[model samples]
Target: MTSTTASRPVGAKPAQGSNLSLGSLLRRPEAGAFLGLLAVLIFFAAFGGLTFLKPAGMSSWLNVAANLGIIAIPVGLLMIAGELDISVGAMVPFGAMTVAVISGHYGMSIWLGIAVTMAFGVTVGLINGYMVIRTAVPSLIVTLGSLFAVQGIVLGLTVLITKSTSVALTVDGPAKVIFGDFLFGGQLQVMVIWWLVLTAAYVFFIHFSPKGNWIFAMGGDKVSARNAGIPTDRMTIVLFVLSSTSAAFVGMCQAILYNSAQVAGGQSFIFNSIISVVVGGVLLTGGFGSVVGIFFGTITFAIVNQGIYYTDFDRNWSALIIGVLLLLAVLMNNTFRKMALSATTKKKGA
Candidate 1:
C-alpha cells in the first residue's frame, strides 16, 4: 500500500493525452489536405462573400469536383502504388464514343453499350498493365502510348461510322435516373452522390483492408514488396484497370447526362486529374496519400477554379489565382509532411 505506482490491468493500453492525440491527428495523410481545404474555403469566403457560399455557387464547384474526384482517386491510388496512367485521357472519349456509337447510332440497348464500353476500358487497362510489367518500360511512356492510340481509334471510328465528330443519345429509363439525373432542385448532379459513395468505398479499401498495405509496400519498394509475396504484378494490373475504367465511367456518365458525346472532349482529364491528385497531397515519387486527401484536394481545386467567378477579381486572373492557390497547397502539404516525419523521429528517439 506504501507504493506510489499506480496499478494497471494486464494488456491495458496507456491513455493518450490531448497533445498526443493532436500530434497523431496531424500525422495522418489527410491532415495537410484538410488544412489546405480549410485555408482555401476561408480565402474564398473572404473575397467572394456570401454568394460564393450559396447553394448555387457551391453546386458549380461541387459538380466539377465530383467529376474530377472520381478520376483523381484511382489515379492517386496508382500514383501511391508507384505507377501512373495518363491513358485515362483517351479512355474518356473512347468510352463516350463506344457507348454513343452502340446505343445512339445503332439504336442498340444502352445496357449493351455500357457493357461494351466498360469492356474496352478493361482491355486497354490490361494492355497498359501487361506492357508496363513485362517490358520494363516506364509506366508513363506505356500509358502515353495508349493515350494517343486510343484517341486515334476514337476519332477514326467516330468519323468513319457516323460521319460526324459528335453523337447524340436519348435515354428514357432507369439508366437515365441512375447515372445522369440531377438532384435537389437540379442544383447538383447525381454524380456527386456517386462520388461520395465511391470515396467512402475507396477510403475503406485503402485504410481498412489488408490489400491496402500491399499498395503502400509496392509503392515503397516494388522489389522488396514482391519478395514479401504481395502479388505486386496483379495489384499493378488491378490499379490500372480501376484507373482506366473509372475514366471510362465518367465519360459514359457525361455522355448520358449531356445527351451527346464528342470525340474531341475529355483530353483535359489527364492534366486535371494529375493536378487534383498532387494537390491532394500524394507524393509524386509515390508511397504516400489517402483517398480523403484526394477528396479534399479535388474540392480545393474546384473551389479555386469556380471561386473566381464569384469574386470581384478580373476573370482573366482566374488562372493565376488557381496556380497560386495550388502552389500554396502543395507547399503546405510538404511542410506538414516534414513536420510529421520530424515528430515521428523524435518520438522514436524518445
Candidate 2:
C-alpha cells in the first residue's frame, strides 16, 4: 500500500526562490496603505508648504492619529473578524465621564478613577460581547443599542450628580506624566508613545503569533473556523472587549489631558475610527486587513483632516476636501489589492 504522507519529505525546503521581490512586497496587505499615506503626506506638504512638514505641524496630526489609532486598531480587528463595535462612540464619553466624576467630582484618588473607568469599560465590553454572542443579533445592532444606552447613562448620571454636562479634572504626579502629559517641548502627547507600543504589540500578536491566524480565519468564515476547532466564541468576545476598552482608554486619557469632559464631544470618534479602518484597507465586509495598514490609514486620515488648516483653502471647504481625498485613497487601495491578487493568481497558474 502507498504511504499516505509520502508527497514531501519532512523539513524539506520549497523549490521556489525567496519571496523578497518587489512584486511580493507589493502583495502585502499594508503596501497599499503605505502608498496612500505617502500620497496624502506629499499632497499636503506640497500645498501647505514647509510649515506642514515642520515638527510642530507634524505633531498636530500625529497627536490626533495617536488617539484615533488606539481605537481604530481594535475596531479594525473586530472588522477583520466580521464584527463591528459602534458602542465605542459612547464608550469614549463614558470613560471620560467616569474618570471625571470619580476623581474630579467625588475627589477620589486618580488611580482609583483610572481603575474604575477601566473596570466600567471592561464591564460594558463584556455585556456587549455576551449580548452579541447569545442574542444572535448583528454586532452593529447590539453595539448600536449599547451606544445609545451608554450615552443616556452618561447624560443622566452626569446631570444627576454633577449638575452639569461638563466635568473638570486635575491630574497630578504619575497619572499625568504617564497618561495625559505632553512630551518633547510639549508638542507630543504621551498617548503617542502608548499608541506606538500598542501597535507594535498588536503587530506581533496578529502577524507573528498563532492566535492571529485564528482571527483571520474567524473573519473569513466563522462557522468553518469553529468547525475547524478554533475558539470563535471566545475570540469574538475578546475582540469586543478590546474595542470597547480601547475607546474608554482614549477617553480617559483625554479627560486627564484636557482637564475636562463634555457629554457630546466623542461622537466624532465613531465615524472617524471607521473611516480610518476602511481607508487603511480593511474591507467593510470583513476578512481582510492588517494592523500596519490601519496605522498608516489613521495617519493618512489625520493628515487630511489637519492639513487643511495649514493651506489657504477656505475652512468651509475642509469637509469637501477630506471626503474627496478619502474616497480617492480607498479607490487606490482597492486597485492595489486587485493588482496583488492578480499577480498571485498568475503565479499560481504558472
Candidate 3:
C-alpha cells in the first residue's frame, strides 16, 4: 500500500509502517550522509597511513570533532526547526571573556564566572529568538545581524574592561577538574566526555521522546505545526537559547582548559559548524535529519580537516585537497539522496 506523506522532506517524520528491508534502510534520511562518512574514513585511512588511526592521531581529530559537534548538533536542531544562529561564533569568545574577566581578572569565584557565562548565552539566545519571532524576518538575516553585533559588543566590552583583547584564566579545584582538564594521559580533552554525554542527551531528546516528534513537525511545516499546538515560537526561542548556550559552554570550557581566552579565535566555528551539519545529512531546507547522521558527519569533516596532517601531501596544497575531498563527499551524499527520492517514488507508484 502507498504510504501517505506530507510536503515534509523524507525522514522529517517516522517511516509510515513497519517494513524492514535494505531499500527501507537506504531510504532513511541519514543513510546517504552515513555512507559518505564511511567513504571519507576509508579514503583518509588509505592515504593518511595507520598513524592517523593511532591514539594520538585519533585524539587530535576526536577532540576537534567533539568541540565542533557540540555546537553543530544544536545548530542542526535549529536548522531542523527552520532557524539559524550565527551569533554562536561571537558567543564563544564572549563567554570566555565573561568568565575570564569576572573570575580570572578580578579574582572572583570561578563558579560565579561560569554561571554568568551561561546566563549571557541565554540572554543572547532570547534576543535572537525575539527579533526573529517578533519582526517576522528570516532567521538567517536575523542571526547574521546578531553575528556582527555580538562580535563588536564582545570586543568593545572586552577591551574596555580589561584593556586587552586577550584574557588569562586560572582555575583549580572541582571547577577545574570538571569543566576543563587534561584527561586520559593529556592526549584527550575533558570536552570529549562532555560531548559524548551531551550527544546522548540529545539523542534521547530527539529520538526517544514526544518532543522529538514536535521538532520534526516544526521542521516539516512551522505554520501547520503551530496550528496543531506545537508552539513554534517557543520552540524556536528555546532552540536559539540552546545553540548560544552550547557555544558559550564550549568557549568557557576552552578557557578553563587552556588557562586563556582570545577574542579573535572563534570565528571559524560559524562556517565549520554549518558545514558539518550539512555534511551530516541535514537538509538546508529543514525537516529531515538525524542526530546520528550529524555525529558521523562531524567525524567525517574532522577527519578531512585533521587527516591531512598525517598524509604526505605538500603542506601548501592541503587546503585544496581538503576542499576537493569534501566536495566529493557532498556529491556522494547527493547521489544517495537521489536514490532515496527514487525509491520513494517507486514505492508510491507501486
Q: Local distance difference test, per candidate?
A: 0.87, 0.88, 0.84
- Give the poorly placed runs of model 1, Cα more than 4 Å off: 1-20, 348-350
Clashes of each: 0, 0, 0
lDDT winner between candidates 1 and 2: 2
Clashes of 1: 0
Q: What's the lDDT for residue 205 in model 3?
A: 94
Writing each residue's lDDT as its tens digit, candidate 1 over 1-350 gives 01222554475345423333577667667777788788878888899886767889988999999998999999999999999999999998898889999999998999999999999989999999999999999999999999999999999999999999999998768998888878855778899999999999998899888889899889999999999999999999999999999999999988998899999878888888888888888888889888888998899888888988988988798778667767876787788788877985666453
Q: Write one digit per residue (lDDT tens) for candidate 3, span 1-350.
A: 12333444555435543445667666666676678777777877888777878989989999999999999999999988877778888988888888999998899999999999999999999999999899978989998998899889889988998899999999999999899887855678889999999989998999888898788889889889999999888888999999999999999999999899988878888888888888777777788777887887788788878888888876676567656655765666677677877876766653
Tens digits of per-residue lDDT for model 2, 1-350: 11233365566456533467577666667777788788877887788886767889989999999999999999999999999999999999999999999999999999999999999989999999999889989999999999999999999999999999999999999999999999955789999999999999999999888899999999999999999999888998899999899999999999999999988878889989998998888877788889998998899888888888899887687678668767876787787778877986666554
lDDT of 2 at 81: 93
Q: Estimate each model's TM-score.
A: 0.93, 0.93, 0.91
State the local distance difference test value for candidate 3. Answer: 0.84
* Candidate 2 TM-score versus the reference: 0.93
